[model samples]
Target chain A: MKMVLAILISAILVDNFVLSKFLGICPFLGVSKKLDSAVGMSVAVTFVMLMASAATWPIYYYILVPDYTYLNTIVFILVIAALVQLVETVLKRFIPSLHKSLGVYLPLITTNCAVLGLAILNIDETYTFFQSVVNALGAGVGFLLAMVLFSGVRMRMESATETPKAYQGIPITLVAASIVAMGFMGFAGVADGIFG
Target chain B: MEKKGRLSLLFNGVIKENPVLVLLLGTCPTLAVSTMAVNGLGMGAAATFVLICSNVVIAMLKNVIPDKVRIPCYIVIIAGFVTMVQLIVKAYAPEVDQALGLFLPLIVVNCIILGRAEMFASKNSVLNSALDGLGMGLGFTLALLIMGSVREILGSGTWFGIPITAGRIDPMSIFLLAPGGFFVYGTIIAALNKLTKGRAIKRKSMGCDGCPSAAACGGAGTGQCPPDKEGQS
Candidate 1:
């Protein structure tokens, strides 16, 4: 239980996916233009991360690492693709509303580096099954947190009247991210406590 | 089918339509791993090799892949190439592989690869697709190198591994970090946007009417296209 909490907190705060580790910056920037899409993208990342961990953890331990380790990349990717498909079906069947909300994003999650990164990271870090799941959940939540925060900030940046001639649009967004990243720097202590 | 005109395809990835600056795909790598010029060049070369190879293979097998599973098929092909590169780099340039880290395998998910596959390779002939991949790969490398140079100098006081900042400057480490990546990419993109505008002005002076995709624009849904984009280059 303590380890579970450690992984969760470590992923969410200490080594935050977006702000600190820089896993999923594409969606954090692109889908974050709108608040709704930002939230939607977060949910999608969460789903993919959770399912990817659940699936890839076993594949790593039983199949890939022990037997065909050379095929880690290929196998992990194939597993992630299958898991995305499974999640799509489950969402479409169980949560139609969620399916609608995360329509295209459901599949797009397959391409989200965060998902594949987490899947491979599971093996790299060699987390226990439960730990990997908790870590994935926390990482997903962290990604959502960072994306929403960025979107909210960008919403403000867009509405502002003007700025320096140079620091407009993307330049400014990046500056804002720099500040956000600095803020996340404070959470580095979280990892110290967890790994300690 | 025959590939589009060679010059058009080649030039497209460089200026008129750079995958990173213009199309805005692969934002993760553009902003994450471009901290050092060497890392950027290594990653770019690796990505370029994979991009060209994957484009050719995918384009040739375009007809074989069913439309429904096209995304999966393209991903598998891409993942295969990425794995091959990963192994090679791991064996030889382990340092570069470490610098890239997860971003290497993350190539499977790099939108630039699949985006090009779905948009250009899936439709065009093998020759054009290979050329497109080569051009896009070079443009991507150029963007990375530019960003890498900016970050390395400002953030670390070094240029391409030669320590030029010995007691000469105090680097802003933030610019070398991930956030720094975004700021650099944004500024470079804004600059590129301005250059595109300059070209547009020249074309308008020459009386070419306007761009082909002017009606389409960048933010098609939001109706806020980036100032001027005459993809006529």
Candidate 2:
């Protein structure tokens, strides 16, 4: 039980996906422009990551490793692509509001490094099926936390300087990411106390 | 179809369309591996190998793949090349392979490789496609090396892991960490924009209407915008 909480905190805070491990940075820098859009992208990514880990865990342990681990990457991508497509449809049909908001971003999830990164991380650590699921959820939450916070910062900075000639667009956002990454490092010690 | 020329392909990748700086693709490895000069070099070589292999194969098999499953086909080709890279690296340079960690496999999904395969390789001839991949891969490696060298010199007070400032000066440790990577990446990109986009920026200053499809100037001239499927897209 203690290890469980440790896993959650460490994954979400101390060894963050974006800052420490550097997994999923493509989305971290790509989608983290506007606060609202960042929030939306985070939610969608979190959802896909959780589901991706869920699906890929079984695929890795039961199907791929047992028979043909060589087929791992191809199969994993196929599963993720199919899952993203299915989620896109379900969103379009079931969650109309979310579909409207995340219309195009849904398909982009198919190519998101974060989701694929999470899938690989789960296997790299050799977590059991259930543990992979939990870790996946934790990673998704961490992605959301970082994405939302970074998004909020970028949103503020967007209107902060009237867009300087030098630090105009992507450069400014990168500076914002630097600050966020530094701030997130503060959580490195949190897992120690709770887990211990 | 116009017989694809080699110079056009080479020119497309070098100055006009760099994978990292201009297109903003594959920034993850750009930031992470750019921490050390050796790692940067190794990564560049590895990516170049995979890119060249996958681009050639994809260019050859382009006509055979269906439109709907093109993405998956690209993934399969890329994943095969990545696996081959993994094996070759482990066999020849296990240390570098281990250091790269999951990033070696992650190359399978790199936007630059897949982006080129989808946009240029799939549509162009094999020879020109190979040239395009080689040029772009070299350009990317060059960028990574420069970024890594800058960060290593500042962050660790060394170059390529060799101690340079020991007992001499304080290391600007910020360049070694994640925030450091971000600032370095940002500064490097800002430099590129200023150097290359002077005309674009000037036109914008003179108010030349909307953003001049900033991509063409920064993309392989495949008669299209940035393949939409580029970047994290």
Best by DockQ: 2
TM, chain A, every candidate: 0.92, 0.90
- Candidate 1 has which clashing residue pairs, if any? none
What TM-score do all the candidates reach, one by one? 0.87, 0.88
DockQ value of candidate 1: 0.30
Against the native complex, each candidate's DockQ, computed on alpha carbons, is 0.30, 0.44
Worst 10 residues of 2 chain B by lDDT: B202-211
- Regions more than 4 Å wrong, model 1: A164-167, A193-195, B1-4, B195-233
lDDT of 1 by residue, A169-193 (tens): 5556767887887788788777666
What Cα-based lDDT does every candidate model obtain? 0.74, 0.75
lDDT of 1: 0.74
Instruction: State the lDDT at A157 in candidate 1.
Output: 87
For candidate 1, write residues B1-233 as lDDT tens digits. Answer: 33457877887887677767666666777778889998999989989999999999999998998876676777789889998999999999999988998888888877677778877898898998999999999988987888899999989889987888869789999887666776777677667647655331112210012222222222111122222210110
